[model samples]
Target: MEVTLLFVSFFTLLFIGVPIAITLGISSLLYLVTSGIPLTIVPQKMYSGLDSFVLLCVPGFILAGNLMNSGNITDQIIRLSNAMVGHIRGGLGLANVAGSMLFGGVSGTAVADTASIGSVMIPGMKKNGYDGPFAAAVTAASSTIGPIIPPSLPMIIVGTLTGLSVGQLFLAGAVPGLLLGFGMMITVYILAIKRNYPKGERVSFKELLSAFKSSSGAISLTFLILFGIVGGFFTPTEASIVASFYAVVLGLYVYKGLKFKDLPKILLSTAITSASLMVLVGLANVFGWILTSEKIPQMISNLILGISENPIIVLLIINLLLLFVGTFMETIAALIILFPTLLGVAVGVGVDPIHFGIIAVLNLMIGLSTPPVGVCLFVASSISGISMEKVSKAIIPFIICNLIVLMLVTYIPELSLWLPKFFF
Candidate 1:
């Protein structure tokens, strides 16, 4: 009965459009009250959840991303991407995917990727003879790559949850992230050809060199993060601080895009984003505590194992479940709630923790572009001035492309495991 109230209240508040963090808090409160537990556990659990050293990386990364975006890094990335791929059929679309790949390294969040890149690419694509829906679809679909690449916010959360090596998790995601980006590019190429999309004139080698030179500072930040973490120069949290300091220097002096006057606004935006995420984490921890008390994770593990102990079948079912959940739940909230439980099931079947982390994040990242509550889809549609239905219809091909990549990563643990092993 307590568990029933917990889920009933959770889904009810969710369906009524309450914020996800609040929905989690309220559902947990209901469960506690009905089970005769003291209300004080709420604050206690929330405090415990937020009391982690690793979580400092969240705000640090967010601030760094904001600083870089304010510094006009997005334009440089798009320019470099366009110079590289703009001559190909569906060149702008290819550039969109490529830009997301580059921008993802800095921003580490899909929403930021979509907003920053979509604001530029969606409009440019439309003006250059691409349909609004196609432009929006490409923008939304490609943004999922943000969290899959290194310097990812989702990977940080996964590390925090399971105490897995954050650096290894970051490395594990690199190949799969690239796979998703390339898959989207292929889809864009196919669609571009089918629709007779226009392509830009090929740039001279000298021009491409200029583009690369212009964006080298921004590109170097990604390598700095990877090298710093993997080489033991700094921990993941310290890497974020370093990244922020680097972004500041680049923006204020090198790029000349960020000014002293812009500091207050950027700081305020980072505080708000960081605070909201921390709150969600706290509430999710409380919700997860309730589930543990009820033996929910054990029950779920047993149920899944009962269906079949075959690792392949178990993994496929887990993938489908996560994909379905991703369509409705916010990524971090979903991670905080489901990842621990799912990790148990995956490990029981002899799957490596690092590899499973990549698989889980990829599933949820794709969900960010799916319908019903796909936040990236909404952001892209708003930017493109198109209906959600049109964007949804247009994104189908890219979704299929992402699913193909997801399956590859799922079946082949080596795809995720190779980099971490090679590097570490």
Candidate 2:
């Protein structure tokens, strides 16, 4: 009965358009009140959720990305991408995908990737004769690569929840992240051929070298992060701090793009974004505690086991469930609520928890591009000045491309595990 009230209240609040964090708080509060538990438990669990060294990466990484953006780093990276691939058929579209992959290494969240890259690419694609919906579709789909690469916010949250080696999880995502990016590029190539998309004249070798030289500082940050974590120079949390410090230096000295006056706006933006994420984490922690107290994880495990014990079939079921959940739920909230329960089931059936973490994060990242509640979808569609319905139709093929990659990551554990093993 208590669990029923929890679900009922949560769904009710969600359907009524309450913010997800508040819905989690209220639903958990209802479960506690009805069960005669003291309200102090709420504050206790919320603090427990927020008090983690690993989570320090959230603000640090967000600040790093924001500082770099103010420093004009994104524009440099896009210039490099354009020089390398922007002459191909669907050249601008290819540049969009390439830019997302580069920015993903810096930003760590797909929404940021969508907003940052979409603001530039979507309009440019449309002005260059690309259909508005297709442009929006490509932008939204490529943004999913953000969380799959290193410095990933989702991987950080996954580490906090499961206590897996955050470094290993970070490495595990590298191969599949590259795979997803290349897959999207392939989709773009096919579409470009079929639709007769325009292409630019090939750039001279001198131009490509000049573009790379200009973006070298921004590109170096990507290598800095991967090496810092992989070489044990610092923990992922500390790497974020290092990245932020480097971004500041580059902004002040190298690029001279960020000024003293920009500090207030940049700091305020970081504060607002960080505060919202931390609140969601706190509330989701409380709601997760309620579910645990009710043995919801065990119940879910039993339900799945009742259907089939085959690891392949079980994983397929979990992936489908997560894919559906991603279409409507916020990624972090869903991770906090569902990760442990699903992790337990995955581990019980011989799936590596590390591999499962990559798979789960990959699934939710895809949701950012999906409709109804896909934040990336909304961002892309709005920038393109089209309704979600229009982008939704155009994005379907790309989503199918992503699902193909997700399935490979799911069934082939080596896709995620090989890198961690090779480096370690």
* Top model number, TM-score: 1
Residue pairs with colliding backbones in model 2 are none
TM-score of each: 0.99, 0.98
Instruction: Evaluate model 1: give its lDDT.
Output: 0.95
Query: What pairs collide in candidate 1?
Result: none
Clashes of each: 0, 0
Q: Encode model 1's per-residue lDDT on 218-315: one tens digit a residue.
A: 99999999989999999999999999999999999988999999999999999999999999999999999989988998998999999999999999
- Where in model 1 is the C-alpha error above 4 Å? none
Write down the TM-score for model 2: 0.98
Lowest-lDDT window of 10 residues in candidate 2?
Answer: 367-376
Q: Compared with the true structure, what per-residue lDDT tens digits does model 2 show for residues 148-250?
A: 9987999999999989988899899999999999999999999998999999888999999998998898878878998889899999889999999999999
Question: Alpha carbon lDDT of residue 204, candidate 2?
Answer: 97
Tell me, by lDDT, which candidate is best: 1
Model 1 Cα RMSD, Å? 0.7
lDDT of each: 0.95, 0.92
